[model samples]
Target: MADVVLQTINLTKEFTKRKGLSSPRHFFDKVTFTAVRDVDLTVERGEIFGLLGPNGAGKTTLTKMLCTLMLPSGGSATINGYDIVRQQNQVKRSIALISSEERSFYWRLTGRENLKFFAALYGLSGRAARSRIDEVLELIGMAAAADRRFQEYSTGMKQRMALARGLLADPEIFFMDEPTKGLDPVATRQLHDFIRDELVRQGKTVVLATHHLAEAEQVCDRIGIMSNGEMKACGCVSDLVGEASLIEYFHLLIEESRLEQ
Candidate 1:
């Protein structure tokens, strides 16, 4: 039996846009834009599931809903068998979020210092926190640079630090949103290897949202292609790309989706 770790049923998110206050109609009228619509997704344990989409495709919205950062306007989801809506705390405990946002960290703080602070937020302290921080630093191959100020670190090192922070809690699942954004090709490849070689080795399930089709093909075990708030296609890489390059197939699906819209 396959162990399912994440599941979503008709997951949807909508944002309301109102006109300016100068217009009388603003008070009475609103436009509803659906960011994610009826997205049914399933991710199995210990597998890297990629959410591949272009901008405005709702990949980030879907991830946010699953992470409990944004409440779904409709439908439901569960992480590690815990309801994302009803059991918010439990859902949070079961997963970690990693993004390529360097501003989330204090510039002056050393990498180790930053991890320690985040560890405290995770309810770990003293020897337990220290041990975990050390473990993650080594795991991300940043033990030597742990004491360097975050601002001094290269983009790749910063990304590794972000991964280290995510691993602090040892969550069963990781939700990464454009984690390799702004990284060079070499750095991106290195990050991909770390995710596959080290993170998967620990039996962790990863949900990666990225615009890089090549990265998705290289890293993800299975991928779901999203377009205009809907899942356009999904399956194993080899199965989906049979007889055609992934780039060609990806463009075909995206073009077909545009025509339907």
Candidate 2:
């Protein structure tokens, strides 16, 4: 059997609804939304696994639950054999989340300063933090602009900084949500190359959540297609594609999901 680095067994998340603050029964109101339901998935060590879904497909919510950033309503997960709920700290230490959102960083801080600050949060300090920060800057090809303020950097550079922050802890698994969102084709290709050539080569297991079928096909070893809070299909890229193109296969699965619902 492959070395499974991440596994979720029927993991589920539901949010209870509340009425307006003026209503007396608002506190008692209990409508609910199931964002993720019975999601059973496995990611092998040192492979890029893609979770492909449209917007609001519960990809982010599932990621948050696995990362221990959000609590699951049912089921459980393990990261490198550590239970996510019972061993939250161990799970957190073993993974990193790279989101496309640039607002997560302090706009006033320089690229290096932002990285240094985040590195400090991960417990590295002084010379050690500086060394790691420098190494990451070089890794992302941002050494030349390390001193530039974050707001001054273009969208591509900001994305690189986000990647740097995620790499500061040197986690074993990386969870990336739409890493190339809103990027020009050139920038997107650059990020894709970095991910495959550098990160994968360095032996990190990556779990990528993206809506771009072609990009996922290019980078993922295996992919799970999610729709409306459920996984419709999962397999190696070739298996998933077969005679159909990835986009065609994706649309077929999505249509099937709609009919099932």
Candidate 3:
């Protein structure tokens, strides 16, 4: 069996709905709404596992929980066999996050300067960090722009820089949320190729959360369809999309979700 990069058991999150000050107050006024309910899932090592859902479908929330950004209200999770809650540091050390809304860096600094700062934080400091910074800048094709100020870089260039920083830690797993969200067509395709290459060549696992069905279908080894705080179906690309187009499969799953509510 493949190693488990990430796993969740009966994972759940609840938000307490607070009543308005002007509204009638009662003991039952405050209610709990589960954002993720009793979710049990596993992601295998070296596999690109996609989580697909519409807006407000709990994809982001679930990712947050897996990355230890938010505490789970119930159940448990482990990253690379280390408990996410009990062994937060070990979990963090094993994974890297590449957010679509990449963090802004000092615009005055060079592209390579930003990556060096991140590399140092990952404890890859001094000569080694400097060398790795150069390596990643080249690996991501940012070497040509390495000495240029980040403010002068284009949107796609900045996105590539952010991704380079994510890889600086030499992480075993990557959590990428809508990685190609704002890129142009060419940039998006370049990024898609890079993601695939990482899995096929470098043997890293990924948790990819995106609304793009076709992209998910093309890249994922397995996919889980989530809606309304639950997983509707999960399997290989063809297994779930078999005998139907991806668009049709998505609609069918979504319609089933509505019927449940």
lDDT of 3 at 118: 78
Off by over 4 Å in 2: 19-29, 243-246, 253-261
Which lDDT tens digits does candidate 2 get at residues 174-239? Answer: 999898998899999998898899888999999999988889999999999888788878889988
lDDT of 1 at 225: 91
lDDT of 1 by residue, 107-198 (tens): 89999999999999998999999999999998888999999999999988999999999999999999999999999998898889989998
**Candidate 3, clashing residue pairs?**
none
What is the C-alpha lDDT profile of model 3 across 1-261, one tens digit per residue? 767878899988888876656466663477778888888999988889999977666888899888889899999999999998899889889988887874557788988888888787798989999888888888899999999999898889988998898889889998988888889999998888998985458989988998789889988888988888887778888877785576776777677666765
What candidate 1 gets wrong by more than 4 Å, as runs, is 21-27, 243-246, 252-261
Which portions of model 3 miss their true places by more than 4 Å? 21-28, 243-246, 252-261
Clashing residue pairs in candidate 2 (N, C-alpha, C atoms within 3 angstroms): none
Q: Sorted on TM-score, highest at the top, how do the candidates line up?
A: 1, 2, 3
Model 1 TM-score (2 dp)? 0.93
Q: Which of the predicted structures, 1 or 3, would earn the higher lDDT when compared with the native?
A: 1
Worst 10 residues of 3 by lDDT: 19-28
**Number of the top TM-score candidate:** 1
Local distance difference test values of all predictions, in order: 0.91, 0.89, 0.85
- State the lDDT at 222 in candidate 1: 95
Q: Is candidate 2 or candidate 3 better by TM-score?
A: 2
